[model samples]
Target: MKNIIILCFVCLVTISDTNSSSDGKEKCEGIYVRDKFHKKVVIGMGLNRPYQLAYDHHNHKIFFSYNIGKDDEDSFQIGFLEKGHIKHKVLKEVENGFAIAINNNDNVVYFGGSDGIYKQHLKSNDSVIEKILSHQNIWDMFFKHHLYFIAYPSQKLYKYEHRQNKTIPEHQKIIHEKIFQFAIDGDEDKFFTNETGLYRIKNSTDHRIFYEGPKVYRAIEIDNKGVPHFSGQNGIFVVNKKNDTLEKIAHVKNIFGLAFDNDNNIVYSDPHEIVKLLPEDC
Candidate 1:
């Protein structure tokens, strides 16, 4: 039954985590990526293209998608950074994937591909279930607040509420339009980016515009302070609601993915080079 599958999935991940540790330290401890922000750290020179990043705090893993806009069979790959370095053999090759997210609770990776969104077991490197929901060709997704919100090119939104049967959770069309990238803080307030501008969704329903300009925002991430920060074609900017202006934070260009680390450090990428923003630098 579904309950038994859930139990086995959890146990396997836990055992894998336990076995991957050494000297009372996580296998990833001391093997973090060196900062490559705004610099020419071309980790993507060998790949086709990369986009979307998901950091799994529970297992100290980084999941990402590459080879965007390619055919489902040969265009995309689901990759990860583990044991303090890039590990190509960890996860199986995926097709038509544009974005990815990690369920830290279950040690699984949910990815959007040409067909639809699928959840895969990290420990076994096997696709756990076929097709989590509808909306073919998922462009992006986020696993936050116990819900999986995904977007499509046609401006459709789909979400799956947290449940034991995540592989087959009932999908809901909650948001009527599309969101390029999104981030949610502890307050459940979501900051999103679209073709028009940067926006905010508060109280789970009330939507408001944050910034509207010529800049095409690419990444949306919230810091520990409840304020939202964005990266885009120009550079990185943080919300300064008091002045109704976006405070420029970093001058990097073309940030394709963004997230806040456990220590509130910013982790982002140019869709090629992944970097961590340290407190001293930011």
Candidate 2:
């Protein structure tokens, strides 16, 4: 049972603390993330059950999903982080939160849930959320060239283009089975992962199996040069666009969320703590 609990945590669903302190803050474990020097530091705490993360390097902000239910509470939440402060709002309408994407044109973050996709103006005084699209369960989303490519677990995919100068979205449809996470390359190429392999979508007509193996992998995190990295059963692995080969970065497992800054510094969270795989000390 103990191992099962840890596996469930690694598989993405998480449990939360149910108490608040006299300071009017939620009583949970302190937030700890390893810095670029591979040094661990306690940053902040009181998050319910922090899950998938999206980093906005252009704005120096982070967005994540968490459980908001605690001690008679009954909601899930999405959190925004900026300048060491976090503000979370309850997502009462979203049933299951899965993915997040940041749009460079507007600098707004879009969140995917079981029911629909939603967005809000970041750091706005009036926090009104706008629904982008409705689906049964949105698994992941990616933004490229003023458009969003959304993944559905029901073996379908859709493209939403921001029209009228990013105000209205025109939706288009496509079907690709088992596709999960995707990232756009500098050449407008798509590098996506699936249930059993890594694939590539290029030239608007080619869907080719780039790599397939016995091991199950998580979503793809691409760097500035279009290199993809992931953390899964074999720890963190990298797929370089130049060679398209799998390279293992670390042996640690149970990585929940992973992000890469421009310098190729890696920050990821396990079930217990966040860690950074800094570039080799040169």
Candidate 3:
């Protein structure tokens, strides 16, 4: 009877493994979403759960942050893919977080680390990485009229005046909730996301909730037409201004970060791949 029971248990384990394998195959090996204006292309592979994505328009490259190893043994590093190149290049291994910002006007790239933010000139012959902001840990950042970052620990938003090397006073209290990421529209309207949902603040006016959802991803961007799009485990979604409704554009799985390239194409990252959404005709 003991031997018979052992054989039954083994058979059950085999059946479970087969079902899990079939389910995974069904989830990953099919077309999940469709769009007329866009076709997806896989540009990166074999990555370790890449998180944030930033495009350098001046250099025509896409930079991404990911871990060098699995949990506990993992270290953060920034990698980039040059236009028309299949090879991935290591930009730098940061000591801390995975936030990256590019100042195309200044030809510089800024990355967040344990100390603060560090800058590297993209065009300069000198390949030195210099620390620009220290003491304050950064979660995520972006550059528009100025440098803006979500501070670590507090999770509040702050703007830095690089020219004067000081934090903007009025921007210190823009919102009450914790911020994860943000984007400024063409009209200078700011959109932020956190645990609660997406928020918008315009012209120093009161913050308005645009979408109420849980745990939106850190990736968000405004297209050239000023439409804001963000991603999460569900898929990529866009905010419809006509009636303030959320629309899912791509049904891709586990999208984590997004950025718009110079030609207005959308580039996004998932667990181990970077893909671009391009016009179908091309």
- Higher-ranked by lDDT: 2 or 3: 3
Model 3 TM-score relative to the real fold:
0.79
Q: What clash pairs does model 1 have? A: none
Instruction: Kindly list the per-residue Cα lDDT of model 1 for residues 1-282, writing each as its tens digit.
Output: 999999999999897778464555434222122222222223223444446767766655666776634445446667766636643332443456677876666777787776777776766534355556564777667676554555555645556664574544344444446666666755677676666777766656866756754357766655556657777765667765565566676666666767655666667776456766543321
Ranking by TM-score: 3, 1, 2
The candidates, ranked best first by lDDT, are 3, 1, 2
Q: Which stretches of candidate 2 lie over 4 Å from their true place?
A: 1-37, 40-49, 67-76, 85-95, 123-127, 146-153, 162-175, 203-207, 212-214, 262-264, 276-282
Best candidate (score: lDDT): 3
Pairs in clash, predicted candidate 2: 31-44
Can you list the residue pairs that collide in candidate 3?
none
Residue by residue across 123-156, what tens digits does model 3's lDDT show? Answer: 8545788877778777888777677888878888
Candidate 1 Cα lDDT to native: 0.61
lDDT (Cα atoms) of all candidates against the true structure: 0.61, 0.59, 0.74
